[model samples]
Target: MAVPAPSAPAATASFTNAGPAGFWQRAAAWSLDAALVAPFAGWLAWPWIAAPAQAWLDQVRALLQHTGQTMGAAIIDGASLPRLAITLLHDPALHQATAAIRSATWAMVWPALLACALLGAIYHVAGECSPWQASPGKRLLGLHAADRRGRRLGTGRALARYSAGALSWATLNLGHLMATAAPEHLALHDRCSDTRVRAARTGLPRWARAWLVLLAIAGLVASAWLAQAAGTVMQAALERALFWPG
Candidate 1:
């Protein structure tokens, strides 16, 4: 009698050998990857961004001159500050300028945003499908993506996982937050792609932690500079609007 055929290996076994990565670990990896790609994407999109930005700045300058002239005359004629502010708010020219600037700014930036997104997608897909089964950032964090059987993903599967990440963003990042609550800390995209971000026994490297600290410090300094610049601009504009020769 012929022996029974060997049973096929179960494909549904969960790959739980390593613990799933936490949300903060995944976020840090993504931030590192974004920082790596941002410069190249900015360079590629500069041409599209520059011209419209210049045009918008020119329009803003013209509006500032017109506003100073209009408001200076009103102030000289003894108009109360409250009334002048109300009149300025109701000015058709001011409204037109606001709308024009908004449109121009959006036009100036969409190409750059698109370029960055495309580059990021390419970077993530290639890295995930590579032998390391992780991007440079993820590898730095000791993380890897694997299928249900803990196998490295093929190119197609990696691409699918990346594509499904759009859903995570589309949900306003609620899908990403799901990882905090889900069993094994699997994110929505991880579930959709039948993959998980697994952490190695090792923790984040010292260099990676230092990089994050420096990045935070730089961000804080930049924000402070921007705030000071904006305050100065407003002060200058107010002075011009109030004291311009009428």
Candidate 2:
């Protein structure tokens, strides 16, 4: 009786309170984030990305002029630029010239990639560590990220999460698919960082959610495609610049 009386207050059991986001929610959030930040990344990398391509185009133009290829020389002379481009695209000489350009440009890709990676890391880490506890995209979608104990991530943890997320995107996105297979819907990056994405209570209807997700995905894809197309056009323009000073 005395021992029992002396016993301290009973310890309270604790349980994990994380709300773990599902695949669709995470995908929607990522799509939104990419839409918002990818352009900035491309802009940051533009100078580095274009330099080698420009140089290669210039070299190709000079060679084409020297070799006396009618279409290539005309392309450089600003004579019916679009028509010449179409002709060159079918020209075997054009293929060889651009092949050299393509090879040279490959090495230059690293700078653009590095710039984009850095921007993306900062964007994700900053958003996750903020008081909002999510990127703007995730917040808009009523989702948040947290640790196993339902705590907001610290900056260090956020950085680690972003770094691991890069791996999740690599390897055919098998790491991301792990979320679908996990009991708690934890992705490989989340597991590696001991974090999870949680959905907050929201009043939006189902249709709105679907539309939002779709819009975000479409925007991200369109932005990426446009960036790539712009780069291609820039390289072609550099070739034309050799003939037309403008």
Against the true structure, whose TM-score is highest?
A: 1
Candidate 2: 10-residue stretch with minimal lDDT: 6-15
Distance (Å) between predicted and true CA of 154, model 2?
A: 1.0
CA deviation > 4 Å runs, candidate 1:
1-16, 56-89, 202-206
Per residue, candidate 2 scores C-alpha lDDT tens digits across 115-181 of 7789888888888887667888788777778788767788999999989987888868999988776
What lDDT does model 2 reach?
Answer: 0.71
Best by lDDT: 1
Could you give me the TM-score of model 2 versus the true structure? Answer: 0.59
> In model 2, which regions exceed 4 Å deviation?
1-18, 52-105, 201-246
Each prediction's number of clashing residue pairs: 0, 1
lDDT of 1 by residue, 1-246 (tens): 997754322321222456878887787788899889999998999989989889887777656756766666676778999988998899999888888888888988898889988998899988887767789988878788888878878889998898899899999999899888745888889999999898875356677678778889999999999767655555566577676553
